[model samples]
Target: MLGAIIGDIVGSRFEFNNHRSKAFDLFTDNCRITDDTIMTLAVASAIMEAEEQLESAAEIGDNNREYYRLVEVLAVKTMQNLGRSYPNYGYGDRFAQWLSSDQPKPYNSFGNGAAMRISPAGFAAKTETEARILSEVITRVSHNHPEGLKGAEATVMAIYMARNGADKQAIRDRINGYFYTLDFTIDGIRDTYRFNETCQETVPQAITAFLESTSFEDAIRTAISVGGDSDTLAAITGAIAEAYYGIPENIKEKALTYLDTNLQAIYEAWQEFKKKRSMNITFRPAKLQEREILFREGYREWPKNRTFEEYCSDNAKEDEYGIRYIMAIDDEILSSVILLELKSIMGKKVYGIGSVLTPQNHTGKGYATTLLRKCLQQIENNDPLIFLYSDINPAFYQRLSFRILPLEFQKVKKSTCMVRCRDENWEALLKSSVALIPDYF
Candidate 1:
């Protein structure tokens, strides 16, 4: 949804006059947030209101279909209200007439407006079926035509696929199989394309622009360069681009400046709702019941000559001190790290970092980095010397200021003992036989 808004603002200046090339400044003084952005936020606000109603109705045992019906009514009402609030914004003539009328009705038009404001449906739904349902409910209020519905549904499905880790080829193939033919390229259509408002003429070209692009900004550039219905085209492309390649922070900051206070407030509220929905991943110490889970993570980190149960039972004793930390999203553990306290050797207790493990599927998302930072903070008061043996991903720990110890101090020549501390005795501690250094990365 934010992607749609950003794209609308960036492409607003070139909506009527076409830009033939992809080389143009994204946000400019001539740029403005158009009806697409206003309507998108209106839909998002309606969804948020509907979610609140669903929560209240769920307590009274209302059926799910009843909740959807309420959402449909609220969506229409919200769009009408927001449309009235911004009278002079760039709305289509028919849409402007509908907005001012006491009886605003679906116009059975196959315009691209349906595709521009349907991103929230994709982001909020948990499944493809739910996405289709939400798309129909939201789109039918204004665009009742089949092409309009198809355009909105396709946009939602593309975002759903991209958000769930689908690649570009997979997205293109699925979209092609489900809806229109996407075999055409942006370059093939860029030169000859003209101002087009119909969903059939605009949505597929916008998607093709995304399919041919390298980054989020490039996708928006490609969409605008096609020249027809630039704001809406870039909006459709931006929605998909946001799901696949996240908007850079600087770009997001600049885009938000174009919106007024009311729209920005709605955007902020929607952001908070998204944050609430994504509150699954958390950090905490391992409980006694999860001892086996923690140990299994450790076993994957160090697959030595021992059964899984044996390794778990051996490490279960660490529960007494409660030093085992795991980063779990829901019931599944994604990463684990341990902070083991050593005995007072030279009148000061030392700490050993161990088992910095991240599962294969959950790598490259910073799970291990988050766990390591938390472990360090948990022991920051002691100012203890943190030591670890990292055979894999040594550069990660090195970036966090862990220095490699001498080769003679290591248990194996290939293995490395790394230390991190404010104290000077870390090097001396690494030389001791009780080092029990790390052997896995």
Candidate 2:
């Protein structure tokens, strides 16, 4: 939601003094990321944290609503926590009260605050119904009014539609069919519009700004020029605009400068979470029926002298978890794979990473690095000395913290044996003569 945050910062200076025109500096020294930006990030953080918890939960039992309930709790608590840290960042009166209260309860108000921070709900949810539910969860914590909930749901649904490749007419039809009327244009509202905080008065105006604009910056300018609750209006408009136009890189970089460390950390974490979530890749072992496809794909990466049947016979076997850890896209197509072999050398556990392969198409996208990180984390818990033989690309493994053993200590002459061992385990692993697997190398 960089678009929404950029809009918030750009419009922050014009929130009170009505601009009434689009011709103005987008970024000024006076502009700052306000409650809209903080609370939007807070919503994203809460949703991500709730998702992680849901994934970690051993059992959902029978109550599927438990997932939404957990998200609701996190949304409310995280908003309050972040709000306290950014106490001076222009919160609405009712929201400010809710944030400070020991037993915080939602005030039945249809404030624009609900719509301004609901962008994350749109991005995180997989379906329209899920987006609606998440928006309601985030909105009702402070703005519990029906109009407030409607505004939040409509904003999120618009973003979800745009993100999923819906046209502007579809977004307009959906928003108008569900929540506020988009009967007015940004130009029509500019001269006469006054500062308004209620969702009914503000949400429609914000939608019109996005509907009439040609670019993301144009959308923010259109929202701000209307001169009614400028920051929140632009935030709501920019959320939709971002999904449609994709904010410019320079604008995103400039907007990030306005955020404090706390907000920046949450934004970065949310970005990383979104990136991983969007990969649509899974790590698993080859099934009995798909063994041939796996072998064919593996052969494409490393076309050695071995036949496909021989490759299948070799990698078809499994480790303790019965997984060869193939990183596959769409379950049938293999993008990368890592063969794991664990052994006991000199009374110490040792893990060997071998047969690391990523097809030509997926070579530079860090899929190998992703697998390496996952394998390293799994090994670190058991305190094993990890080693890998990278004959094809030693530099790639070296970049991932695998260090080459000294020439005097090297047992393999054809390939480099790089090891990643803890400082304490380094001396012990080096002292053992049997730790090096010459055949595997």
Candidate 3:
């Protein structure tokens, strides 16, 4: 959704005055938030509210139908409220009227607004079917036309696939197979494209702009360069690009300045909402009943000479600095790791992570990765330096932003040592000074 806002602000000035080339400044004084941004945020606000309401309803009984109904009502109310508050921001004639109407209803329109504002659905949904359902529920309050619903669903599907690790070709194939044919390319239509507001004309071009781009910035430029409904086109493109490439920190910081205080609060709340929703797995200290199970699992790593009873007895001994952490789902342990508070080195606190393991059945399901990520988030503060030694490929830890140390700096010979520092200065200090390898791990 931040991607959608960035595209809207960058493309706002170009919507009227078309810049046919990609070489141009991304942000300028002339740029401003438009209806595309307002509507996108409105949809996001609706999703957050709807989810909260659904949770309350779920506590009572089954709320499948109630969830969809809440989204529909909240989307209408939120869009109308925000739209009226920012009436000067470029809304279409019918939509503007709907915003101020005493009793608003779907106008059966096929406007590109549907696609531009529907990116939140893609990010919130857990499955392809849920994506379509969310898109329809949020869209039909105004864009009840078949083409409008189709445009929104296509955009949501692209974002869903991108965020879930689908490659560009796979996303393109899915969009092409289910929604749009996507027969035309951005280069082929750049010179001939004209200002248009219909979903049929806009969604395909926006998606093509994303498909051909190499990065998030390039995607925004590509969409604006095509010369038609620039803000809406780029908003659609940017949403997918964000899901695929992720936004750079610099770009994200600059984009937030365009939003007002109210909108900024909404954006911050959405960030927190997403974090809470994504980390659904429980992370806690292992229970007494699970200790024997974990001990048996840990014994597999060093079964050469130690018997099961010996290993269990050794592990049961209490250590002052060591604590066992586990990731579980409904009382079933999925992954486990031991965290050690090592002695500080050069006045800097150091932590060690070891014995990371996931059951064979849960190996490929990302349980271990989730556990490690949660652990990092919980302990990255307090000016601590975290280290891990991986007997497997170092690339897996690298993806979590852990930097691999040199051979001479490794805690153990032939073992890949990785460090997650608090910042650049901490990393520089670690690199320049002696390596602090914990004796326990």
On TM-score, who's better, 1 or 2? Answer: 1
Go through the candidates in order and give each one's C-alpha lDDT.
0.79, 0.77, 0.83
* lDDT: worst 10-residue window of model 3: 56-65
- lDDT digits (tens) for residues 85-120 of candidate 2: 889999877789989999998889898899999999
**Candidate 2, TM-score vs. the true structure?**
0.64
Candidate 2 C-alpha error for residue 91, in Å: 1.2
Error of 1 at 31 (Å): 0.3
Per-residue accuracy of model 1 over 1-441 as CA lDDT, tens digit each = 889988898899999888989899998899999999988988898878988876752221122577568768988889889999998888889888877888879999789999998999888764455677889989998899999999999999888767755556557766787789987877887888889899889889988888888999999998899998999999999999998889999999999998878888999999998887557977887666776766665687776788887787666655544387888878788788777876555555567787677778676555676577667766655656667877776777764557777676666655677877653566556556644444332
Q: Compared with the true structure, what per-residue lDDT tens digits does model 3 show for residues 1-441? A: 999999999999999899998999999999999999999999999989988876752221122667778888999999989998899998999999999998999999999999999999888775455677889989999999999999999999889777765556556777887788988888899999999999989999998999999999999999999998898999999999999899999999999999999999989998988887656567899888888888888888755489999887777763346788998876888899888788877577788887788887666545576577667656655567778888877887765556787656766675787776645545565567444555435
Off by over 4 Å in 2: 56-63, 281-328, 332-441
What TM-score, computed on C-alpha atoms, does each candidate reach?
0.66, 0.64, 0.66
User: What's the candidate order when arranged by decreasing lDDT?
Assistant: 3, 1, 2
